[model samples]
Target: MSSTTRRRFQHPAALIGAAVLAASITACGSSDTTSATSPATSAPAPASASAAAGVLTVRDPWVKAADKGMTAAFATIVNDGDTDVTITGVSTDVSRAEIHEMAMADGKMTMRQKQGGVVVAARSQVALEPGGDHLMLMDLTRPVRAGDQLDVTLTFADGRTQTFTTVAKPFTGAQESYAPGHGASPAS
Candidate 1:
């Protein structure tokens, strides 16, 4: 056999030795639940009070102000429970708010509503950022101005709900910037 081919094979004794070594390593690392001398594992950190909502936590929710018709809200939702949490719907003090996602389709920027829901996996987080997953507020009852606070409620799959006081901040970022002439003007 060629040296390269021979190098890939090991003797029977070597294989058996490797197997035994692997098993010993695994056993050494295994946690023995019944062992009296075993130290207890630390519990997970508690969720912050301002963010905790049922098993989900919301952080830094804010809405972008537009010059008229629509705007978007962004936040970080963290799932702290053992099971996944899905955001079913959103309610705002506006005409309508819907969960939406923005993506590049055929080289064009396209925005679409999310029919199912936004899922935050167990022990994980989902961020509703400007140009990505976001909450679209349409038919605004009033203009969202900088320094204004709005109430927003999030409905979850497990019948739990969370309400956040989102602040309106003037942002010049590209991620969630409104289209030209899309921002609504203030009524007289």
Candidate 2:
């Protein structure tokens, strides 16, 4: 990886904070009566055919509402497993999705396709939010407005796919400009 890319991964404190938040959300939302000491040992599993059931949980997922062009999705992806997992790609019916990272380019923060993939350390988590790593949704098929629900699927390096739903919300932040051929400017 380049020096700039390496620097982006230097923020351990942020990753840790995201992990803590994800764990708290999982604990609060779970219905299992099992003790905390008896944690599940299996590897991260894909969501079941019915609901979003798996060892990897996406907490508080939401997409930026946009009428056209591009927007992004943010969430805290928690991996409850003994080994690390890499998010290789993302897919949504509404638009094309790519794992993107915001980094300095030409003296300004630019958004581009992330090299390799997003790695969630074992028993840890990663946050996909504005001004950081996010899922870029381009070429929208239709308008995504407030209160709309989007079905997104995350593809893992190991070929396992986890499907989740992210609600569209009105967000004025991260108003970066997007050009069709050129990359995103002034990334948020």
Off by over 4 Å in 1: 1-53, 179-188
TM-score of each: 0.65, 0.69
- Consecutive 10-residue window with the lowest summed lDDT within model 2: 39-48
lDDT of 2 by residue, 1-188 (tens): 99988888778767767666655555466342324322222222222222236547787677777899888888788877889899999999999889998898898787888978799998898989877899999889999987787898999999999888777766645455443544574322
Report how far off residue 10 is in candidate 2 (Å): 49
How close to the true structure is residue 165 of candidate 1, measured as C-alpha lDDT? Answer: 71
Model 2 TM-score on a 0 to 1 scale: 0.69
lDDT of 1 by residue, 52-89 (tens): 22456666566776657788888777777788888988
Report the error of model 1 at residue 34, Å.
Answer: 53
